[model samples]
Target: MYDIYSNAREDSWRFTLGKCGKRKLLTIGLNPSTATKEKSDPTVARVQKVALNNGFDGFVMLNLYPVRATDYRTLPSKVDEEAFSENIQKIEDLIRSEKDPVIWAAWGESITYHSFFRRALTEIISRLTLLDVSWVRFGEMTASGHPRHPSRLAYSWSFSPLDMEGYAHSLRP
Candidate 1:
């Protein structure tokens, strides 16, 4: 197991590298919740299971909320600038060491909305010059227009891989 940040809660994320060793995929999540720890993040687990089921294992997991635990509604203000920077550096280094066309998956909306995850991605994009990446927004459709349930909002969204190819291709100058 890699030495992940100490502050990160257990089961916040999990990584499974592809067995072929040719391609790499990264999955990032909004934060750790009671449900995530208990079930190993069903949404992510489903994806990882699918990858393994299909014979691919190059998957890496990251928790957007590395330092403090907070729900989606409380995320905007709970941002830790320093931790965010450190995590970004770590991710950038990881990407730099890997080959081209890295596949990245953001587990949910909060992961993308939170400054920690967003800034880290921004930094990775600017520093490492990543070629291929994907952002998957999962489980969000469940609560599209419904009144935000305080307890269920975090777990509502199902995993859906959003396109990062076109965005990465557009990045080339």
Candidate 2:
């Protein structure tokens, strides 16, 4: 098993490249959790299961913030601007490298917890739109109006391209 946090240092970003297949997926989430000895976080496992069921052989996981905290509420109040910028660049590079992957908008409702995180998400979504990458909305949206997170997705479901225009308009400037 590959360790996602192998190179991680205190307060630094960390990510794992999941199993690969012919049909590719890119998932953007809030942040990673500390993976234990055997299994990954339930959220990660949920994403993998859905991808495989939807005919996506593999997935590459990224995050809005790469800091490894179990919950967004536990994150530090101050956002690391430099790390956030670098992580965004890394995600963009990965998207550019992949061949028209189905990018899953799986950040869930965590965006509401912090203004800085929401802003970062909006910026990333804008970049995705500019690049013409597809956004996959899984199942129904939450009460907050964002797409359902992987863990919250319907047991049997499919993904569709999100309405980026309307979504962008909804974001506070």
Candidate 3:
């Protein structure tokens, strides 16, 4: 798989930890948390568990922006457009390699915080659509049409890829 997070300051980027190949689950989230060796981020753990249970042998992750920040407000106001654009291309390539992929649109409300971030996210999904990839949700969407945050998903919930026209409409750039 293309290592989108392999850059020098890659510790800031979050990525998949398990098996990766065909029939993959590519999770889309906000910025990554401050996970360390002593503790794993609960959200990433939950997504990994769900992907494994759903027969997805491979997993990947793509975020709206490439930077890492535990809190959204701490993110840089100006994105590194070159790095961000490269990561987006890597995401597109990863999805193309999967025979039947499930992209988890789990960005939650962070999409509402910045117009630039939201526009980049919408463009990523638009590109994915051209590739005919489907999006899956673990639980209910918020009023703004985002899937429940990974931390909010219940262990018993099932995955489903419902019509996202409502979400698409809400993300107009």
Candidate 4:
């Protein structure tokens, strides 16, 4: 069965890996990188490890934006409206698939790469607030208070509760 979901094939504009059971730890990254169903990238590998270590058997990976860029610096200077809207719908579906979903805020400082990052996150937060989801982060937040991205984290690190509302406000301009 294909647990990985995407709106397109070549330039996948929206991607979500929702394997495991209903009890999943959903992670929100700044955007999707190069990971696919056939292979795993460092971020995806790290997320899977963290989830297993933290009591989750499988994980759900989502992102503020879905454009697959090898680096955040390469994401289009602006987001396409269709991609943004579709990604939100995918996010909502993931949320509804679980009970009291526990989400990990792992987008890190890249949230500042563009104004759209915050806007996309704001939309995510709005949708999450409609349900009973738990927001979490790994280790201490950065100096500017963004969540810790898996790439920079120690494998031994664990999760901590993140104040979703306050965290969102801190990112606003």
Candidate 5:
């Protein structure tokens, strides 16, 4: 099944943001970097910092394939469909338990493109029509001044609180 860890020492996945009761946003990622790897993913840290600064109090960061050892680049091959299914169920459980509306924010294109999320969301949409859930893209910028994807802006002008607070403000409703 999907292996989830809470502490930063046990896993690279860390929730650096301050928890203010139930979170209004839930962030999802493909998986955490190998713990033994010297360099951690800068994008993950950036996401955590930005989300916290923007006042997104609650986040559920998930790894579609939760295994201790696996190549991140070749993720499609390593994914266990059964385990992935179970992980989504776990996420749904969290969403159901939340008291406020929670947005489903995808960390990168990898998560947006993953079939597990896209397909599962279609089903979730039908069942939870009144949940007020939506998807927001994160970490599209890079440290080198180059954009993560050429078509998208260096940062999400639409979602970045640093770049623009309009999107965050609009979420209040």
Candidate 6:
């Protein structure tokens, strides 16, 4: 839809991407990469494969942060309050109306990458708490209990249920 659902023309940040269907899989990564509506990076391609293979009509790519950095290690140590606020708002708009929305907690180990990342996820989960959202995980949760990222695997696996709210609360320093 619209090549891909995105908020800006620049690549520094991506609030949302992917085409929405009546039933779509919403994937949340740590941050955005170089992919756009015109092209897909490895991770986005992997997401599309997982969604379609598992019978979803479409997929929506979201992130804990919108900032685009190829290497997450390069992400700012300090959080940008405005960007964080807008990110939460955009996420609400994307998922608020869906009936029984299935969210893929694909952030994996990145949840522990920084306190800001964990904080961002908690805010998003707060909004989803009121809705009938079911969180799913693609493969295995890491040793630390975080869902695995799509880009980490080569084969698609059927999603397993994840205790999203509980998982979010467990993200302690």
Better candidate by lDDT, 2 or 3? 2
- lDDT string for model 4 (40-107, tens) is 88898898889888888778889988888879898779778888888888898878878878999999
Candidate 1 C-alpha lDDT tens digits along 124-152? 56764434544444334333321111233
Go through the candidates in order and give each one's C-alpha lDDT: 0.45, 0.73, 0.69, 0.83, 0.44, 0.82
lDDT of 3: 0.69
Query: Per-residue lDDT tens digits of candidate 3, residues 1-173?
Result: 23223332646654333345556688888766754333456766777788888888656656777676778888777777775776677677767877766788887877778676777776776787766778778877877667777877787888888566567776775
Q: Score residue 42 of candidate 2 by CA lDDT.
A: 82
User: What's the CA RMSD of model 3 in angstroms?
Assistant: 3.2
TM-score of 3: 0.83
| Candidate 5 error regions (>4 Å) | 1-24, 35-41, 64-71, 76-79, 111-117, 120-127, 138-173
lDDT of 2 at 10: 56
Give the per-residue lDDT of model 5 (tens digit) for 1-173: 11223434355333222233445455554554543223334444554445565567544454444433334555555346555555556666656766765443443344344555445444444445556455455444444221232123333443532221332233222
In candidate 3, which residue ranges exceed 4 Å CA deviation?
1-5, 13-18, 35-39
Model 4, which residues run further than 4 Å from truth?
9-11
The lDDT of model 2 is 0.73
Q: lDDT order of candidates, best first?
A: 4, 6, 2, 3, 1, 5
How does residue 171 of candidate 6 score in lDDT? 77
Q: 1-173 in candidate 2: lDDT tens per residue?
A: 42332224554566444666677788888787764334567887888788888888887778888777877899888988876787777778778878876788887877778777777777777676767688878887778778777777776878878886687567676
- Comparing 5 with 6 on lDDT, the higher-scoring candidate is 6
Top lDDT hit: 4
lDDT of 5: 0.44
Listed in order, each prediction's TM-score against the native is 0.54, 0.87, 0.83, 0.94, 0.53, 0.93
Root-mean-square deviation of each candidate, in angstroms? Answer: 7.4, 2.4, 3.2, 1.6, 8.9, 1.6
